[model samples]
Target: MSAPMPTGVHYHQRSRELALTYDINGESQSFRLGAEMLRVYSPSAEVRGHSPEQAVLQTGMKYVGLKNITPVGNYALKLHFDDGHDSGLYTYAYLWEMIENRELWWDDYLHELKKANASREPLGIPLQRQ
Candidate 1:
């Protein structure tokens, strides 16, 4: 089954989040999705690969930012990240899945990072962008 279509999809540059709003049962629900989450969990073949075993683990994406978002027909949106990743076509259902399972997925991602001795920080430093 398809997820409820979003009424609004707006990116907040200052906060680095994609604000998705939907109307369900006459109630308004909004989700603030971080750019880093989108990048690390990208649906592109480069990231997800063709099989589960071939999936690539993304690290150092804590500070990733969205460069652009383009609507793909009416079913999906193409997200372009600042790191030159723009292949993922985020479908409405998939985006909803992210919203519903963020905590679980995040915990799993952190576990994977830890197992690999990976850090979200690049060069172990937090670089401020002006």
Candidate 2:
């Protein structure tokens, strides 16, 4: 109903997923956003670009994981992805936007991948961490 107030955020390394809990309209809601979704939908200039026409489609990022997360002065988070992608600044507003648009964006991504004859799998297998 309104902007969600983030109560907690956690990145699970083993599953490469982010758990977000927020309070909206006095109701607490939780969501688990996957690493592949985050990486592919990064808001960095490299991914989103200066203009819509200049955007780049990310591919072969199925194995990317959340390595670290740093709070950015209360306004945003600096996400360090396992695949050396750490430039995107994910703001609370943007994260909410991601939640809202997840389905449409994912479908578009899948369609793009199919049209490009590309795969979500990585070129090489990822090594398991002990």
Which candidate tops TM-score? 1
Error of 2 at 41 (Å): 0.8
Q: What global local distance difference test value does model 2 have? A: 0.87
Residues 1-130 of candidate 1: C-alpha lDDT, one tens digit per residue? 4598899999998889999999988999899899988988999999999999999989998888888999999899999998899999999999999999999998999999999999777666676754
> What would the per-residue lDDT of candidate 2 be over residues 1-130, giving only the tens digit for each residue?
5557579998887788898898777888888888999998999999989999888888898878887899998778889988899999999888888888888988999998999898888877767765
* lDDT, candidates in the order shown: 0.91, 0.87
Clashes of each: 0, 0
Which ten contiguous residues of candidate 2 have the minimum total lDDT? Answer: 121-130
lDDT of 1 at 59: 91
The alpha-carbon root-mean-square deviation between model 2 and the true structure, to one decimal in Å, is: 1.4
Please report how far candidate 2 places residue 59 from its true position, in Å. 0.8
Candidate 2 global TM-score: 0.91
In terms of lDDT, the best-performing candidate is 1
